[model samples]
Target chain A: MTIYYSEDHEWISVDGNVGTVGITNYAQNALGDIVFVEVPEVGDDFAKGDEVAVVESVKAASEIYSPVGGKITETNGELEDNAALVNSSPDGDGWFFKINISDSGELEGLMDADGYKTFIAGLE
Target chain B: MGAVNNDLLKTPLYSLHEELDGKMVPFAGYLMPVQYPLGVMGEHNHTREKAGLFDVSHMGQVVIKGNNADKWLETLVPGNIIDLKPNRIRYSMFTSEDGGILDDLMITKRENDIFMVVNAACKEQDIAHMRSNLPDHLELAELNNRALVALQGPMAAEVLARFASGADEMDFMSYAEVEICGATCLISRSGYTGEDGHEISIPAQKAIEVCKALLSEQEVEAIGLGARDSLRLEAGLCLYGHDITEDTTPVESALIWSIGKRRREEGGFPGAQIILEQISNGTITRKRVGIIPSGRVPAREGTEILDSADNVIGVITSGGFGPTFGGPVAMGYVDIKNSENGTDVFLKVRKNKLEAKVSATPFVPQRYYRKQK
Candidate 1:
């Protein structure tokens, strides 16, 4: 429940270096209906802004950017089988993957829960 | 020139789509519904198992009225048009004199007018073609602003029967003038999903009333372009830009059924010589077969189909994971010999040769109602 946010609309909470990440509800609503989820393999390292995943809705394919420099520790295997979960619970059970953050200091630049809420609200 | 002002193309049911949280996309210059919150696969499966409604307002509606309308139109298209009964629809194609398909269209005979529907993107060209080719006595009235909707799936007729009284009386390919929700419009018993459904053409202002009346039924749900694509694919129907084009002749695309018996023997429309010759002598090559990828990965358009020896034989036209079929399906051209029912083939997918097989079309069986009478 240690909600940390990325400018890319992804968020995570860390238990030591191991953390869970998923897109905000705003991203899911904007994407409109998750049809397919393309996830990177476990142990794949990614830098911020690197395309780590692909989510396809009905008409378009959206790229999910890495929220922080991290090594993939685990992925939501359930999404591979049931992509619709991302649409139903984007923030909770639909968390895309678990990444082990390579640097905890990166959190200093990320948005807090209150700041992300304000940022999202301003978008409308 | 219209200057591509898309704001004018909104349908009467636009607000309803927004209410259902439909994702909009720009198609044929109109802000259109591509999918609802359920996405393409879900909507497609729902249509197969239940029912779906579509806003097809982009299609062109035209009326050809004159003493010689039928006789004149017969010269342009390759259907038995002059023989169509007053209320029946006949599927036909406008041919270039050299035998290329200019465009495919549907024609209906009214008391004093011959009404027509053409693809949304090609309407301007179609009207222009008809105007120049048709003599001065024949008048072409383009109803470009009308809105059309297609109620599809097995339960479609049941839903439409509530508002359009006496809807069940019509059979497949039949249409008539019907009053729906206190509005007069043309309702046709034809659709692109290869199912027993109806295509309703109404004035732009009255379209929403019809949509509301149909949506009132618990069995009806609004569908978008995403599901529309998959449903048509599952039905083995062709999309204009993907499955067909002007450069591709009708013979090679396996559209011989559209060519009538008399036209085949008499040879009057465009490209009659080449078309008739190919019919008997066999097309130099034919578009045939379907492909199902082994994995969940979908082979999109332009993906190469190869033989065991790695020979690029054909190109994939339309490919995606079908909701009803429960797997990825693709349609493409293949050599006639390898186009048999169960031939093994391979598709090149992102550095991997995925196992695929040539299978017959309509991966999901169509559920359309038909009446003998």
Candidate 2:
């Protein structure tokens, strides 16, 4: 149940071949309020760095990149109506989409919690 | 951080905000609070449902006094300042010789001097403009040491009434000096958010105490510049940098009514000729409306707005997802024909044509509280 983070501030929790994806808490903090989450439809496939989700705040809108190659297995319908759930629980219930990882090897490119903490610290 | 930076611009409540765990951001050359511990969304929703306390201490507060106060200000801007009775506020724009917007500001006629509050980023320039143009007898004093806090939302009056008795009784666009949080201040029943609210101008040192005092109420939380943008946007209120600028005129920006009838007829202020002409003939271009993309994409600033045939009609001046509206909205100058309320439009997001509709402003209905009597 460990979380991995992309440099772009998206996070994924891996279990076997599945990765539960959402923006990091840091991303939510930076984004102010979550007004919209433009999630890809289930079965949509994207390569790493492809625009998978669009997260918006009151002031700005930003693209959420897929940290790894994957086929979207499920999209968080809750975000469609209550995007602020991402601001409240970015790590758990606020997860954006579930993707079946085409290559777990891509996880190597992402960072773990400690690494993500260090990365956020380095940002300061 | 201390009050003075290298350039010495300071928000009156700078240190107070820091003490309250506010995240200070460098905005328009001044260090100001963008949010507090409850966060931007919480703050924004709180203001909508209850009340939000904003440290608008960065805005420039000036006192223009003398027998010719109205006369001098009138010459510089084509607004009816002379008609502003004491305890009333007016939304006016500073105009250039050609009738372009200098900046938008609030002018309140107090018991004594005329209290003027201009945008934080444009404060220095506005003060300079006033000083250069105002007659010598009409003195300008920069009240730089005061804090301006806006208590906005539906419950704003209820929260302020606890401290300032009869605050709820005040009508829209009215002001009165009251004592609260152990400080004397000017309280105005006005706000950028199209809601019932109050903007309190308190002494610098008492800013934090007043904020804390307001926070003592369960309904009040500190909102940052983030929610401030959304609330104002939902109200269709113009932001100086995004919606209005020196190159944009009042008529073109769809704010001709702000030019008081007296000013329009007097025709003595700066840029009166062009403004009056534009008012009569109508500006060829108009600032149109834009709603959120029905698709899962955001149309940001500088995104091109296109007509049905894919011809570029205008550029987005301000576009963002409104938390309250549950979608994105934007404003921009389009051809006059496309400025109608129900115009069909598309926003070009990257390579995709995202569907958008030209909608009326105040996307949310204004809930301002005016006295029944």
Candidate 3:
């Protein structure tokens, strides 16, 4: 699986045609404590950069944009009762949804893991 | 997005905050920490359960002295400053000439002078307002060389008593000068958080030492502005610019109790005519009320309030998830007719209409340290 990141701090891990999407660890840390997560419904369609989800922290609410155009196949239901999972394991169990990639070419526009690290460093 | 601008002022505790990995943000022209590694929720819960140390040096501290100081102050605010006994603190606000709130502040009657703590954002303007209004005989001395810190929670008294003698014996709203960690500090048994706490005003040079000594106590952990905001909201307190502004009147803001009975009867302070008229006639158009949203969706500031008929009635001033209350709570102004307790209201959050009710506050019971007789 190859991980791609957006400048907006969202991350997606791709395997075959399906991609698992979640906020990056850096993003979760910046957001502080997660209080609520609003996930998109299964079978919802989205284009790249469309606001597909919301993550509310103790401070403020942030929108999560779709990294690539796709149809949502599944959502992490555990976040309904346990939003802290996003802060605890943002890259793993805290995944927001699974999307069926509409176009593989869209992933090329995103930064790779190393490139994302350098980008985040520049932010500091 | 890059490092905080160097031009922003830093409090004496700036190095300590960086050492603790505090998330620095620019607020009110100061580079201050909004949260720590534990995050806002964790820091908030820690303060509720144990004790939280807050760096509140950004707030303005001033001393008003000279003969007839209290009498002169009484003309500016609606509260009874002249009758306030020595060493006692009273919550009051500076009222505009037209019956609007200029700024809310805490005034303490010290031995020979009055000490005031004003909001950080309004300090400069407040000083100018007071200076321009007061006679030359009355002196206003801004204490720029002091730093304020708050130790708050159920364990606050116990933790504070370790260093400052006589702290455990102080009652709510009372203050005393004491030696803490070898620095002479003015400690007050009052805080914005509803929890039992003490706000210590220490010398700017000794602020870091005093804070370090307090943090050494196991019960005390450094909290940030994030938890401070949530804690005050849960306590149903008014934030300066949001909950109470120049556009809001004290009567409409539900702060009528802060006005002294004598001040309420005789007209002396600014806006006395209008405030007293509203008091006797009960003709306040809008009134502040607490609200509890029905679901986990937190209603934020600027959310519109609607009545049963779906007509707009009010707008939320402050709203968020209360860590201590374990739910979403808010406070806002509604039409006087719909401001009664238990009045059903709807909040327009985004595109959906959420169910809510006007409820009484402080959502959690206030735990002030009143000396038991």
Candidate 4:
């Protein structure tokens, strides 16, 4: 599996033609407590940079954008009842959705592990 | 006058907040901690179960002293300030000439003077309003050297009692001067969290020392503004800017309970005519009511409220997730006819119309301490 990160703090772990999407640790930390999460529907088609989900904290609501164009194959239904999973495990069980990649070339635009670390460092 | 510079002001506990890993954010032109390492949810739950300390120095505290100070101040608000006994506090508001609220404040009658705490954003204008209308004999002194902190939650009184003797005996809405950590402090047995707690005002120089002492207790944790906002919202308290603004009248905001019967009958304060008529004739067009969204989605501020037929009935003023309530909670101004409790409403968030209900406030029950008769 290859992992890529977006500037908006979303992480996609690609395996074959499917990629699992979720927010990064830094993004979840910045968002604080996760009270509500509106995940995308299965079979929904989205283009790159489309607002796919929304994460509401106690203080504010933040949008989650799609990093690459794809059709959502599955969504983490557990998030409907336990949104705090995004805060506890942003990169693992907290995965928001699984999308079938429409074009493999879009991965070139995202950052790798080292590059994302450097990008977050610049933010601080 | 607008602040030309971009620099944000810091409270006396700025350094302490940073030391505690508080996420600093800009609020009311001041750098304040939005949340600490525990996060807003943790901090909120901790505050409800135990004690939480907060740095509220950004609020404006002032002293008004003179003969007939209470009567003089009563002219600005709709509360019965003249009847307020020494050390008793009354929640009041400054109303405009047209029956709109200018600012909400806490007025405490001390032995020789009246101590008032106003919202930080409205302090300058509130002070200016009081100064221009002063009777010459009355003096308003803004306290810049004081830092206010609130110790709130179920265990707050027990934690504070270790420092200030007899603090637990003070009745809710009572104020007193007490010595804690070698500093003379003004303590109020009241809080915004709907919990039994105290709001302490200490010298700015002694703020750090006093806060450190309060935090040293096992049950106490340093809470931030984020949790404070949620806590107050859960408690059904109104935020000055969002819930009650200069354009919102006290009658429309469901704060008529704070007005005394004498003030309602005599009609002496600003906007008294309009306000009194609204009280007698039930002429308010909009009413503030608690909204509970049925779904997990939160209907944030500015979200539109719709009736069953999709007609826009009102707008949400304050909306967020209430950790204590374990669900989405909100307060908004709805058409008076649709403001009944259990009336079904709809919240327009993004493209979705979530189901919501108009309900009574304080999603969580308030636990105020009242002295046994």
Candidate 5:
């Protein structure tokens, strides 16, 4: 499994043709308390960089974009009842959706874990 | 984006907020803490359950003195300033000639002068308005050297009583001059949050000392602007720029109660003609109403309000998750016909239309401390 990060602060962990996506820990921290989340339905097709989800914190709402072109396979429905999982575990059980990758080449545009660390470091 | 804006002014407790890991954000031309490590929801819940200390130094504090101060003030606001007893506080607004609200403020009649607190964003204009209209004998002076802070919640009275004698005994909307941390502080048993609290105006030099002492209390925790917003929203308090703006009238905003009965009959304030006409004829086209979204989705400010047929009827002015209410709570202006309690409204949040209902507010029952007879 390989984890890639988007400039928008979304993270995708790719394994085979499937990739699990969620916001990074840094993104969750900046968003304050998670109150509501609107996830994409399963089997919804999206192109790279399309807005696929929305995360609403106490302050404001933020959009989550598709890291790469893909069709959503599953969504973390647990968020509908308890959105704080995104704040407690942004990378693990807090995952937003699973996408079946449409193009392996699109993953090249995202940053590796090491590169993402550097990118986030510069943000501070 | 993490870098602080050098142009923004810093309050006296800025360094203390930084040391406490507060996330500083630009607000009303000042570098104010939006939240601390506890986050907005936690801070809001803590404030409701225990007590939370807030640094409100950014708000504008001013003193009005000299001859006929109350009479002069009565000309600007619709509240009955003449009848307001010394040490009593009254919520009022400066209305425009056209019945639009200029700004909402707290007026405390002191021994020899009237102390007023206005919104930070509208302070300059409010001061200029008062100054330009002042008579030769009247004086309006801004309290530039004071830092205002609020200790709010159910435990607030107990925590404050430890530092200042007679703190807990003060009635709601009453004021007193008390010595806290060796400084003469103007303490008022009033706050935007629905919970029992006191807003203390301390000398700028003694702000940190007083705040530190308050935070040392077992029941008190440092809260930030984020929680303050949610707390006030749940309290059914209006935010100046959002819920009540220059374009909104007090009658339309459902703040008609703040206007004294005498003022309603004898019109004399800026917008007397227009506001009084609206009062007598019930001509307010739009009225503010409390809204509770049926689902978890928050219908944020500017979201269009629609009827069952999808026709736009109103707009949400303030909306967010109410941590204490355990769901989404909002306040907005709707057509008078659709402003009845329990009226169903649809909120256009993005492309999705969320179901919501018009309900009465102080989403959580107000817990203000009022002395019983």
Candidate 6:
């Protein structure tokens, strides 16, 4: 599986046509403590840059944008009870949803691991 | 964010906040920390369970002296300043001519002078207002050489007693001069968090030393404005700008308790006619009340509140996730008819209307320490 990141700080791990999406570690760190996670429902279709989820922190609520065009296949139900997982493990068990890719070409616009590292460094 | 300009003010602990990896933000023309590495939720929970130290030096502190100080102050607010005993603090507000709140503040009556703490953003206006209305005999002096810090929580007194003697003997809303870490400071047994805590005023040059000393204790940790805001919100306290703006009146904001009994009977302060009339006639159109949304989605400021018929009844003034309540708790104004406890309401959150209820304030029960007679 190869992980790709978007400039908006969303990350997606791709395996075949299925891609699991979540926010990057940098995004969670900047968001502080995650109190609520509004995940996209299964079968919800979204294009790149579409607001698909909401993550509410103690200070403010922020929207999580979709990194690529796809239909949500499954959402991580554990987030409803344990939203802090996003802060503890942003890119692993904290995945927000899994999406079935509608078009492989949409993934081309996202950055690879090294490119994302440079992108985040530029933010500082 | 980085400092927008060189003109912004810096607190005495600015470097210490930076060293602790605090995310600095510009607030009320001062570069201050909004959150540190512990995060807002962590800081908030820590404050409820242990203790949190907040750098509130940005707030304006002023001392009023002279024989006519109490009489001069009565012209500004509706609180009973003349009857306030020495070393006791009273929560009050500066009122406008039209019965609106100019700014809320804490007034401490000392034996020789009156000490006042006002909001940072309104400090200039407050000073100008007081100066223009001052009787020549009364002198108002701003304490620019002092830094204020609030140590709050259930464990606050225990940690504070370690440094300042006689801290444990102070009841809620009491003030005294105490020695802490070799510095003589003015300490008040009061805080905005609705918890047993104290606000200490120290010399600006020695602020860092005092703060470092307190933070070295096991129960104390440095908190930021973000957690301070959440804690105050959970405590059902008003945020000066957001909750009690100049457009809102004290009676309408549900702060009628702050008005003294004598002031309510024979009123002479600004807007006394309107406030006194509202108190007796039951003519207040709206009232501020606590709001509890039924879901996890935090209803934030500006969220519209609706009645059962879908009519916009009011708007949220302060709303957020309460760390102790483990749910979304908010405070907002509603139509006076709909402001009763347990009244069902709806919050328009994005595309959905979430169910909410009007509840009694201090979403979590206040843990203030009251003296047992």
Q: Which candidate number has the best TM-score?
A: 5
Question: Quality of candidate 4's docking, in CAPRI categories?
Answer: high
Runs in model 2 lying further than 4 Å from the true structure: A1-3, A13-20, A40-47, A69-78, A81-85, A96-106, A121-124, B1-10, B288-298
TM-score of chain B of each: 0.94, 0.95, 0.98, 0.98, 0.99, 0.98
Candidate 2: residue B306 Cα off by (Å): 1.3
List, residue by residue over A35-117, the lDDT tens digit for candidate 4: 88898889999999999999998989999999999999999999999999999899998899999999989999999999999
Q: Assess the local accuracy of residue B366 in candidate 6 as a C-alpha lDDT between 0 and 100.
A: 89
Where does candidate 6 clash, by residue pair? Answer: none
Error of 3 at A11 (Å): 1.7
- All candidates: CA RMSD in angstroms? 3.2, 3.1, 1.5, 1.8, 1.0, 1.3
The Cα RMSD across the true interface for model 2 is 2.4
Model 4 error, position A101 (Å): 1.5
Q: In order, what lDDT does every prediction score?
A: 0.80, 0.83, 0.93, 0.94, 0.94, 0.93
Q: Write the per-residue lDDT of candidate 5 for residues B1-373, one digit (tens) a residue.
A: 4355888989989889999999999999999999999999999999999999999999999999998899999999999999999999999999999999999999999989999999999999999999888786887899999999999999998889898878999999999999998999999999988999899999999999999999998898999999999999999999999999888889999999999999998888998998999888999989999999999999899999999999999999999999999999999999999999999999999989989999999899999999986
Off by over 4 Å in 3: B1-4
Candidate 3 per-residue C-alpha lDDT over B1-373 given as tens digits, one digit per residue, 9 for 90 to 100:
3455777888889999999999889888788899998889999999999999999999999999999899999989999998999999999999987789999999999999999999999999999999999999988999999999999999999989989867978999998999987889999999999999999999999999999999999998999999999999999899999999898889999999999899998869888888888899997999999999998778899999998789999999999889889888999999999999999999998767999999999998889988988
CA displacement after TM-score superposition, residue A11 of candidate 2 (Å) = 3.2
**Which candidate model has the greater DockQ, 1 or 5?**
5
lDDT of 4: 0.94
Worst 10 residues of 6 chain A by lDDT: A40-49
